[model samples]
Every structure is written in structure tokens, then in C-alpha cells.
Target: MQHSYRQLADLLSKEIRAGRYQVGERLPSVRSYAETHHFSVSTVIRCYRYMESQGLVEARNKSGMFVADWKIQNASADKTTQGKKQPAPPSVEYDKLISLQHRMTELYSLTAQPLHLGLHLASAAPQWYPCEALSKIAQRQLRQQPWQIGDYPTGTGLPALKTGLISWLATCGIDLEPADLLITNGSTEALNVALRAVAQPGDAIIVESPVYFGLLQMIENLGLKAIEIPCVPGAGISLEALEYALEHQTSVRAVVAMPNFQNPLGCAMPEKNKKRLLRLVEQYDLALIEDDVFGDLSHQQERPLAIKAWDKSGRVIYCGSCSKSLAPAFRIGWIAGGRYQSRINSLKLSSSLITPLFEQAVLAEYMQSGALPSHLRKLRERLVANIPLAIAAIQRYFPAGTQVVSPAGGWWLWLELPEHIDSLALLRQAVGKGIAFTPGTLFSSSSKFSHFLRMNIGRPWGREMEQGIKTLGKLAAELHV
Candidate 1:
């Protein structure tokens, strides 16, 4: 009961600090707030009282609460404007890429523990998924097809799952048939196949600066070079910079992008930029690997459209998965390989033969059951509410000059700490304190983002999660130079 009120208080506190309510502005009445959030009136009263104690709001005589003239406790706005001027694309350094791979391996081995607060991985807690529904579907599938367990995967994917994915992709404004889609182990495999379909050893692939570390590892493992283009916060890759790189980097064969809710930065590309990207790719005659794994988890009423949605030239190799949205353990991801469908299918066959049949069958049934939309809706709400809580904790605890990017959608919170605070060193200290987060060094081929870090707020916001953030902030402050 107490925790419930505190959660409300914390959320409101974040809003207040974000300038949603101005000084001396009247706040919603306790009763109104309670009714809107479905909290008890008593809980709302307690919340208001707590805020009053914290100097965030003040109670008026016989009137409602008002915003107090309190100093905003959150991190100040970032000094560096994100999208104002396009910087030249950074050269892809081979030595830096090798260092990234080694550092990532070390970090993963260190954080692979049951008790670690793993805010590094871009996945949500299991409770956020419809596990009971999926389990029931799996049980029904196995009972109906008893011999499925002993069977090997026959082709690229189960037909039923592909059919279901067709309907699901339509929701994201991407129109494709099952013939165009190939299922893989997850987005990881889907991206790998997509990259292999377009580029080979020594080929240069364009990637967002401070991109997902896994993508860097893939580039390194495949012996491909990356041309790092900068991305704007809350928006995606810079079209101007990308065009510049395409013009200069003659060996570039493919451009990999997460147009919607990019990992770490949590940015999406605008529709105009997406269309322009398609045009650019057609002009360059290079493939575009669109990773839309985070597309379905929109925090807004209308979901953002993917670059694949506007593709006409078939240059866009679309990749997505249920890993982030529906199921993690199932590892069900698909690719609409566009012009490279045949190549991707061949690669898929030679690699895994097929994605697991049972899990695909289970997901197919679950999707058709009309549960995914509601499940995603509830999951998005949880993420929306949880983001601010983490940000508020960061503001209250971290040292001054810390800047956090509050993305419109997705579970990540990208933070820029004091310039001298090495996030990797902070991660080491945080691990000692039973917390884990992604050091921004892993995100880039260069050490440009050594002061940055990414946090996953997909877990349920609670005392423990807040404590983890607090510990990370303390560690960051101690390392602040």
C-alpha cells in the first residue's frame, strides 16, 4: 500500500521536475488524480503529502495542491544539441572494433549472474510477457502434434507462423507475404542473414554511431568494416551524414539501421527520412537492413512506420522479432529479405536449417488468438510509466552535468555522464554493488561515448530497481573527474 503511493509520488515528481507543472501552478486534485490512475483516494492523499514533504507541491487552504517553487532536481538539459549540425561520419577503425569485441566478452562474462541487476540487455522481465497464455498455446500445440518433438525443422519456418507474421507485420504498416519472409533463431540471426545476403568479407557497412554493440560484434566476426554515422536522440540516423558516407565510402555495400526505437539511443527515423533513405539506397545500389525489433512497442497511440513500409525498390531487407515484444526465450524472428530473399533463405538453410517448429507453432497460435495487441498495449504502458521513474532516480542521485535522453518509446535510457567519468569503470564499480548496465564504450567502434551508458527500464520499477539506479549513480559520482 505504501509502495503504491510512493510510486505515484515518484512519477509525479518526475513530471514536475520535467517542467510539466510550473511554479505556483495548480496540480490535479487528489481525488482527480486517484480516479484517473485508479488509485485509492487515500493513496493519492498520501502521495500528495509525500510530495508536499519533498517541497514539490504545496497544499492550499480548502483548495487543491499547487506546484511549489522548488528547484528542478533532475539533470540539466544536454549542452550539445543532438541534431543541429551534421558532423562528418567517423572512420571505421579495425583496432577499435577488435577492442570492442574483447571488452564486450569480458563484460558479458562478468555480468552473467543470477543476482545481477541486468539493465544492460535490451529485454524486459518475464512477468511483462503473456507466459501463461503462451504456455497454454504450447501445450495445446504439442498435444495436437505429438511427434513434433522428435522432428527436425523442415524448411525456413512453419507455414502457420509465417502466415501469422504476415498479419502481424501488417500492423506495422509493412505489407509482405509469407514467401518474402524467412524465420530465424531471433533478430540476431535475422540480422546476420540479412548482412550476409548483401555484404561479404572486407565490405563496408554503414551503421549508426554509438550503435548496438552486438551489431559491431557481427561486423567484426564477418570481417566487414563499419562506417559510423551519427544518430540524433529521439530521432534516428542522420540522413545528411548517411548520404555523405554513401558518396565517399565507395566500398560500402550495405547500410544497417534500426529505424524505429533503436537500441541504446531509442530513436526512430522520421517518415521523410525513411523515404529519402530508400532513395539513397536505390541510388547507391546498396542494401538496407532494417532492424525493427522495437517497432511494435510504441508508447504513442499510433505506431511509427518502418522504412520497409515505404520500400518500393525492394532494397530494404526488413528484420524483426517477437523477442522484444512477445517472447524472448522462443527466439522467433523473421526477415522480409526483399530482393535478397533467395540468398537469405539459402543462408538460413545452410545455417540453422530452420527455426524451432514447436515454438513457432506456439507463437502462431498465440498471435491468432487476438492476445498480442492487448498484451503489447499493457506492456507498453508499463514501459511508459517505468521510464520516468528511472529518470527521476537518476536526476536525484547522479552528479550535476549528467544528461539523460528520454526517448519517446522503447525501454532504454541513454545517459551522458560528466565528461571524465568512464562508464566502463563505473560498470566495474556497479558490478561490485550488484548492479549491471551497458557501458557506452561498447556501443561505438571508437571510444567517443566512453562517458555514456545505457539502462534498461523494462523491469518493473520498484524499491530494488530504484536502489540499483541509486547505486549506479553513486558509483558514477565517485568516478567523476
Candidate 2:
């Protein structure tokens, strides 16, 4: 199908763009790529053909494929015009530095692998998903006369969905209106839209060190510069460092953060700190983009009030997604822009015509049916049960002196590995045994967490997973020794 081909093309393109492949580098043989990805060789061949058409790569008569040498003279010119002066002649491209150390067939090379415990994948939980219920809703929508899959979600999203979200937020003491909301493909897209709407290329954005890798990737792709402030697990970013950065860095355009159950560190900013941040944002006339993707997944029933709720001047852009709470595949997320709603909406329209309509409709129906609350309750219970199990496993199997952060919410465990062991190297060894996890370095601009790893605690424990953890622990211990 055309859809499948596009997916394959996207997968390959991401890898190539991420610099996993270098110019003139040989690609993995078709058989290897196909086997690793579980795709047919024919599909991979088609993908390769598509890549060739895009000038992303070239095929050799017998040596397989190589990344093409796209001239960056124009890129260099643009960078120069943008005030980026290079010491070198600009003839040296980063593409040349890309490592060809591993076979190009590894998907994990492009993205962080969930923990070996199989506990972190959003798709791992099936019991909490109301699949049949969603199907019924979709069926009902299709049964209508002259059925349409639904129109692309406008900036305001489905009006009913927006209204449902407003009602839902009211229960948490956050009052919002349909006019304040914008629907996005997911939290990732919402963050992308927010970044594009507010930040120009080369603008400085302050981020929590050991933050989410996905956000870091977004910042990199957009050419936005980031300043990192050390963040402690169970506490948020160092306030003094952030304040200093804001005061000294006049070019700083925004503060992007995850105040609740922050990715990788799983740190929740305290209420006082949230207020202090709000005040600072107001004082500096800076925008606050809050990523609350895991807002609903806290093990604690009483969730912290969102920083957006405290924004009086409409400086906060609050983003949330059902992907974390329900299903990542659903890809349903929304943004509440207190004052920047129209700007964000315009950016969304320019980027992607709209979020898919059917998925939004189905999600709206599920919310209206009161299924989401019950699902969250069950999901929270499951995560609470699994978190301790994962912790115990790590304690039992990991190297001595390893530190584990027990988050009050979210399904991630941030592990402080032995100082000498590199998480990336550990990841390399673990993936060789069909195990994977998010390395801590990806979370920061400076890659400060090279000695740490984040384990997903969402999946059920298993023998293979435990064995993998043991192997990793032994490896870490060996490195320590």
C-alpha cells in the first residue's frame, strides 16, 4: 500500500537526516534491513528507490547504497547570511563526521529504545485501552449518511472535543474555553508548532538538563540554540541557574519544560517553584511552553496543578496528549494557548493541514462516554504496581551503589549508573542482546547524563527483561571495577 511505502520512506529518511548514515557510506544489505525491521525485501527496495528519487542517497551497481553528497554551498550561504560566521571555509560538513560504526539496519539507532524490561513502551498496555469502545464510536461516525472520515481538525480542533477538554480541565480547577485550544497530531507536533510559532532560528531556549530527548531533537532540527540548567531528580531545574541564564541571556526567547513527571528525570517541579517560574516569565516577557504529556499518568491520585493554571498574563502554552495516557498510536493531543492561540493555530495550519479528523472524533466520543477517566484510573494502578517491581529488579540485579529515583508519578525510573560506565556504550551492548533503553545523554544539550539511563516502568516484568537487566548490571559493575 502507498501508506506502507511512505512509512518505510519516512523511517529511512529520519535515519539519514539524523546522520546515522554518511555520504558514500554503504547501507546495510537489503536482506539485513528487511530482517531487522520485519519488512519484506521488496518493501525496503521500494524505500531505497524512493530515497534515490529524493537525492538523499544513491545506489551502486554492486556495492549497495550510499548517502549522497548534497552540496551545502547554499546552506552555508544561508547560515552566513543568518549571522553564523564559521572559522573554517564551510567546506567541512557534519555529514562527514557521522559514525558508520554500526550496520545501518538498526532502528534503535535513530530513536531511544524503551527499557529492556519492556516496561516503558506506550503500546505495551492493552487492558487500559478501550479499543472496542473506540471502534464502536468510529463505526457510528461512519454509519452516518454520506459518511465522511471527518474534516481535518481546524486550529480549534473538533469543537466538541475542545468543549470536552475544557470540561475535563474544570475538574482540576483549570478553566479554559474552546477558543483557547488547538488540536495537534500529538504532543510532539504540538511542541513543534509551539516552537515554530514562537521561536526564530538561533533563538535561545532554556531547557532542563537531562530533559526529554525528543524535545532536544526538535530544538536541533529547528536550529534553535538551547541553554541547559542542571535539574535534580524529584526536584526540577536549578532555579538559581535558570534565573541567571534568563538575566544574562537577553536572546533567550522561551522556556520549554515538563513541570510534571518530566521525561527521563521524572522530576515534578514544586508548587512554589512553579509560581516563581511564572513570575520570572512575566517579568522577562518570555513565553512558557509547558509539556504536560504525562500529566495524567501520575501514581498519585491528586495531581499537581499545572503551571498554565497560574498564568494570569496568558504567557503559558500548555500541551497535553492522550498518547501517554491512552494510546500513542491514537496520536491525539491538544494545546491550550492562553493568548497565543491564534498564532499557534496559524502555525499548525501551515505545518500540517490539520490533525486527522477521525481520530479526534473517536477520542471526543470516548471522553464524552466517560471512558477516559476509568481508563486513567486503571492505567495509574498498573503503573503504580509495575514501578516498584522495576525498582526491585534493578536493585537486585544492577551494580552496587547505583541510585534509583522513585517518581511519585509516570512510568519511568531514572537510574544513576556507576560513574565510569557510559550509558550509550551500555545501550550498545544491551541492544546486541535484544534489549534497549533510553540513555541519559540524549536528554541534555551538553549530554551531561552520560553516566545515567532511564528505564521504562510501564510494561509487565518478564524473564528475558530481567535477564537483560542482570546483564546490564554486570556490565556496569565490570566497568566500575
**Residue 266 accuracy (lDDT) in model 1:** 85
In terms of lDDT, model 2 sits at 0.74
lDDT digits (tens) for residues 396-464 of candidate 1: 999999999987778999999988777776776677677888888888878789789999999888999
**Cα misplacement distance, residue 410 of candidate 2 (Å):** 0.7
> lDDT, candidate 2, residue 106?
30
Q: How many residue pairs clash in each candidate at the backbone level?
A: 0, 2
Task: Estimate every model's Cα lDDT from 0 to 1.
Answer: 0.83, 0.74
Q: Which candidate is the best by lDDT?
A: 1
**Top model by TM-score, which number?**
1
lDDT of candidate 2 over 122-167, digit per residue (tens): 4445655677888888888888723444343344578878888888
Alpha carbon RMSD to native, model 2:
13.5
